[model samples]
Target: MIEERGRVLSVEPGAVWVETVRSSTCGNCAAKAGCGQELLQRLGSGGSRGFVRALTDRQWQVGDEVVIGVPEDALVRGALWVYMMPLLALFVVALSAQALGGSEPQVILAALAGLAFGFVLVRWHALRASRDPRLTPQVMGAAGFSGVPLTNL
Candidate 1:
């Protein structure tokens, strides 16, 4: 399970709205000094808040800290859907355009079009996935406040 710490914003009948900060484990790496992620982290340190709708059977209150967990496989699948689809679409469309004897410039244009189309398809699929209960993250349990703080809410 991939776990994250978040603060409960509100509690509903079957779920809680949690506000989490954006953080990456790469922040603790010795090589983070030279990592692009570290640079982006520094750049994003203005502290943005992201909200999660976590399904849970436990009671929660405002300001209560919690640990939410999602399956690692789900995250991997989501990452592939968001990143790989456009790349594969570009290559496939470009090759198909070439097979049809399109000019070099036309092939490039076709690839660009394919990339855009893939993004649209991914966006629609993401919307559908968000409504699927099985895909949503779940509240694992309360978290202690003694851990290292990444960012403040």
Candidate 2:
């Protein structure tokens, strides 16, 4: 599980909205001085907060500190779906068009069309995956606790 500490922002039935600060390891990195990402991070607003609605069985109050988590496999699957599918679609369609003796402009248009189709498929998959509990983040436990699940609190 990938976990992060967050503060409860609001509560609804079976769910809590939590806000977590975005953090980076730049401060501890040995190559920070030579990294472009470190420079960009310095230029950008540091530690911006992101809000997420995490599923939970227990009631939580606003301002309560908690830990939230999602499974690592879910993240890997999501990354593949979001990145690989479009590129595969583009290549397959473009190559098919070329094999069929399509003109350069036609092959380019076909590749673009394939890429758009891939995005549409990804959107559909996301909508479906949003309802899958395995893909959703959950409130793991209250912050500062050790090895205790939130349901016990």
Candidate 3:
């Protein structure tokens, strides 16, 4: 499980919206310049806060601290879909165009088209996955009550 500590922003019947700070280890790393996330952080708003709607049965109030987790496999699958799929599409299309004796410009255009299609596919997959309960993060427990069960709260 990948876990992070967050503070509750709001509460509903069976879920809570928690805001977590995006913590990074970039400051200690040597390859900060080569990392895309580091570049995005520098160019973007750099607002470290992120929100998660975590499912939980326990009663929680705004400002409460809690722990949230998602399965590791979920992260791995998501990465593959978001990265590998587009690269694979580009290579396949480029190779196919070359083998078919397409002109240089035609092959380049085909590769770009393939890349765009891959992004569209990814967007569709994301929309469908948004409704999958298995991919949703869950509240592990309230923070600072390691010895107590949440059910007793």
Candidate 4:
């Protein structure tokens, strides 16, 4: 289980939203710095990220510590493919059309269109999946502690 501790912001019969605290270590990572994620992290005014998850055995209060898990299959199958396939498909379609079509500007435009299409497809799929009940994530377990409950100070 991919578990992180967060506080319950809301709860329903099937789900609870726990807000996870993202740490400075997020920006301190070498990969994040190189990827420009550090600058993106700095733009956030909040310390936590809210995750709406399906509830299992866990009892929750507004401030209770709850564990959230995004299944490995879901991570690999849903999130990974949703983004990766689009990009890969973009490049493949673009490069193949360029190589086979024999037109430079057309190839370039095809590639740009592919890239844009890939990004948009990922976002579209993500939104669609989140709205579907079959795709909802499961709850892991619960904890007693909240995040430093994710404070600005």
Q: lDDT of each model, Cα atoms only?
A: 0.88, 0.89, 0.85, 0.68
What does the lDDT read for residue 131 in candidate 3? 87
Better of 1 and 4 by lDDT: 1
Cα displacement (Å) at residue 62, model 4: 2.5
Which structure among the candidates has the greatest lDDT? 2
Each candidate structure's count of clashing pairs: 0, 0, 0, 0
Superposition error at 67 for model 4 (Å): 1.3
Candidate structures ordered by lDDT, highest first: 2, 1, 3, 4
Clashing pairs in 4: none
Model 1: which ten-residue window has the lowest total lDDT? 144-153
What is the Å distance of residue 116 in model 1 from its true position? 1.1
Clashing pairs in 2: none
Candidate 3 lDDT over 14-119, as tens digits, reads 8999988775667778999899767777776454689899999899989888999999999999999999888888889988999999999999999998898888
For model 1, state the Cα shift of residue 69 in Å: 1.0
Q: What's the true lDDT of residue 114 in model 1?
A: 91
What TM-score against the true fold does each predicted structure earn? 0.85, 0.88, 0.82, 0.66
lDDT of 2 by residue, 15-88 (tens): 99998887678999999999877887888855677899999989899989899999999999999999998888
- Candidate 1 collision pairs: none
